[model samples]
Target: MKSPSPGRSSAVRSMRSAPFFTPIRVVFSFAGPSARRPLSFFSPTIRPSAWRGRPWKALRLVPLLSQNFKAEVVAVLMLILFFSWCYCSYVLGCWRLNIALSWFWWRHLDAGLHAVMHGDFRTRHDIQAGLFWIYSLLSHRAMEYYYGARELKGNGMSKHWWHHIYPNDPGRDPDWSTMTGVAWVRRHTSAQWHPCHQWQCWYWLPVSMFLEPLFELIQVACALLEAVASLLEPPMNGPYVSRWAHVLGFLCEVLFNPGFQLVAFGVQPFWKALGVLLLARATSRLLLYPFSEVQHYMPEHILNREAADDSAEWVIGQLLCTANLEFRNRWAWLMDFLMFHGDSHQIEHHLWPAMSFVQYTKASQVVRATCARLRLPYYTVGYFEGYQKICEQVKEHRKPPPRPKRPRSPGEEPSPSESSSTRTRRRTRGS
Candidate 1:
């Protein structure tokens, strides 16, 4: 048999290095809080990197001393979470909140990370990627418990309960208002013709990785303050009291918010720990945000209208507004998890927020066929292609045309200079 060509070998090598094509790189690309490092450390001595070296060694007797450690930490996590959900609902107001954006990575994801910290870089990468894959799948599945059955059972009245029933109202879609990434953009719905949006296709990887966290800092302050307040609040409407709970919780959140949970739990120094965590988050966001943020912004979606109006039928509204992404590749689910089922088949999600990511794909086919049969619009594109469209649309909107150059008179002849230029042009063409 003939040996494979040299060009094919080089092509295979190129594919591995091209980060977008690498499943491991793509999944870990957003290893921020969602990567879910531990909440607190039992041992202040063991380096998290070292924990990966020997997790058994890192498990000291400290956890045994505090029976309530898990409970306290879990409660704090819940507080930050609850405050966030409440805040988003508050901002979007009652008009536009169908569901949580699947944003929070549960405490168990962190717990599992702690348990499996012993591994090589590759092993740890797989663990972080794998853990989210499993947990998000489960969390979204559990969404049915809250949103009702997978079949879209009942349209309960409460804001949280009926999310799947009415997923993507321009006024009622939480995603447009609170999805994540840069505030005042993407998640924050605003009339925008910023040059940044125009050039996002070019600037996304760098600007997103570095600048986004600062934009997210406002959220950090809110979470920490809420934790602080919860700590200070008088239980059962009693008087205020200072306590260790308030201080410790505030400290943990402040330290932990910028991917410092590893610092709290493991052996890394503050700067080193933060630097490493930031790098991972930056890498993750670089790969993740453009696609995630651009979903609703795609040119044809027309989601940025200044005022709400009669949208299409609720299901058609989802298709009209949400960008359907390609994720049929074998490892695309990891990317799906990073993005919280993201734009990758987002229509399937909006139409049936109750469906698991797996089910979303199956359902997308049926939805697509139905849309085709009914002659409805279904916006599907490659993730990068979708972002390109958003940038172009933003650019198009930003540029106001030159005052439509006052129309030339119908019978007007050219000026002497214009006639000379026209003759010159004709001579050049003749040549």
Candidate 2:
């Protein structure tokens, strides 16, 4: 076989260096208000001193459903860099770079979606819809894998807003159990409980870690089917179907889909690179989900519609449903940083969804102090403690729920069925 091109090798090497360089670059560019600089590129162009002691003011600083255009553009460029690395590594058979880049891809998976969620970069004339249309093509690689291809008007923002509206309601929350595997193994709500879930606490952590790649594959297949179906039907257009539409839809869904570009699979080197990709996907989820998943649906928050307090004040309801991850050490903070602080200060994020991640540090302080003063539940558990608590919650609900006792008037005799059962129990005990 001819040796791989030297230029390709050099490009792969350069791409591999991104894992090291990007974080440092991102740290400097996205620096928090506490940094010596006036303000960082990633934050909104506001005075650094304006960030202190005024979380409510910070909320007013950014309008609802708005984002910093330039900062979000830079974030998108970072996403593209990581995505390009994944593509090149796969095509060029650079397994090491491919494996390394997969983690970067998974780490930024939420960040990518959130960037799009936060802003449209002030685009014009339905361009934001087109942007989502394009992102919907690639979003399956993220944790919100299924339903990645949403209707233009009904894209992630709508879906996310729906989640906020119903946070942990049993049936209404779209994110209740997006991962089908977790839905089976653990009950995020009492309604989700099954007898089989009893064993989940023991095995779920290990087993679900490897299932991420499997979930990815399933999501890719689902996206392909959806793409083909959408093309054939061509929503809102006339119902006249053509034969060429069928052929082109099949080709695009199988061949051109960003999630599963199949051209390199015929090559031997692709298999090695694929293994790394799968491993990276699995490993990243293994590390990331414990931090991310524990943010909501804890034991105290296992609410169904009937039991949920829909009438509660908005901020209190948000606080009740969302929990923040606390980092006690530098290592934990590093992990939080890698997660884009999405899990840390989650309570603040839920309360003020439009605030930039860089603004979270100051916002969290204010939120924490106010929660303390008001004596509201401010759940900020250490990373491992949060993980274990969520697992314990799963275990606690594994058994069947205890039967509610029948109420009776004073000195009332048992009903016929109840008396017969009581006699049978007496006879069995005597025997």
Candidate 3:
């Protein structure tokens, strides 16, 4: 074996000295309400380091329980701003700002999904109604129409936890289904390869970036079918199982909802309304997808549960699987805003899933320094570098896997050369 460089050897020694997987002791104080309850954590938590204090305390700088209303307020404000923007752009004919406002609104709503994890929003009903209305009216998604506020919040939290629990684990992580290219476009994992994926690297960018409308339309079509089914025979599960609510929700999605933006656009033609809706969704996806994907798509980080070393500490697995975007001091806030907050500092988000983005920003320094001191892998890349990294990963998987030769037809025997080579290969595998 070749000898490692002096720097590489020293790095290895540091990592070995401070192992990544450190046992975590969690102590829960059950005296208070579940949301307000304080969790006492012993150190060497997440990963081994000299630090002995509660890591959650550092991450949650804000009074999350008391300040949840503030998050709800922000959500309401975002909804107002989006509608206000829609009025100015769509009604007043300032259509150039359409994509920009829609994109911002979409990002905020997407972040609202994260905000829901924090829990106990007094305005949950209002917020959920606004969100459902926005998606249904603008994106023509009937499924959103069916789900009420509580269901939306529950589903969002469950999915978020699942993704964090198994970040970057193909077949296990729910996000993988979306990340591994939609429809025919495939980003092959090591365990799964297909010939179509050979050209994925070449066309993925253009297709994903520009053709979001087509995908959105497909989703809308599927949702429409689902909506019909629900109306005819309501789901046996979920709060809104009644056929009456299904009919009402479907009506709200289509024509009767006060939240519909087309009315503000002033009696626009059906095609025009649909065109605007598609354009909005397409632009939002373009702005959001590329940045949102950067955290998990790093080739080296995507691993199975066994390979991820989950036995050590799940938090260690999170750190390994997730990456962050490096931002300059002056532009960190801007990047955070653009990346839908907390997403730029995804390691912290994964570490403290319940904490808000404000806390993520505040605690990012502590987390980064902790990782550095512990000799843990804390991946961060520039925006361009991260995007290029994703493309490189796709390109790396572009080669089609070698296939075995077809068996000799029915009764026919293989050639003598083929039989001998097969026998030798089988023996080698056995040995």
**What's each prediction's TM-score?**
0.45, 0.62, 0.66
Stretch of 10 with least lDDT, candidate 2: 33-42
Residues 19-83 of candidate 1: C-alpha lDDT, one tens digit per residue: 43333223122222211211111112312331232222322211212122332333235446544
Best by TM-score: 3
Residue lDDT tens for model 2, 266-373: 553666635654666666666666565766455456543334476655566777777787877887665455445345777777766545465576677777777777
lDDT per model, in order?
A: 0.40, 0.51, 0.51
Off by over 4 Å in 2: 1-70, 73-77, 120-137, 140-157, 178-183, 188-198, 211-216, 229-270, 303-308, 329-341, 403-431
How much is 158 displaced in model 1, in angstroms? 7.7
Error of 3 at 141 (Å): 7.2
Candidate 1, residue 36: how far the Cα is off, in Å: 29
Candidate 1 vs 3: which has more lDDT:
3
lDDT of 3 at 183: 52
Number of clashing pairs, model 2?
0
Please identify model 3 stretches exceeding 4 Å from their true place.
Answer: 1-73, 120-157, 179-182, 190-197, 210-212, 225-229, 232-266, 329-332, 338-341, 404-431
Candidates ranked, most accurate by lDDT first:
3, 2, 1
Quote the RMSD, in angstroms, for model 1: 21.4
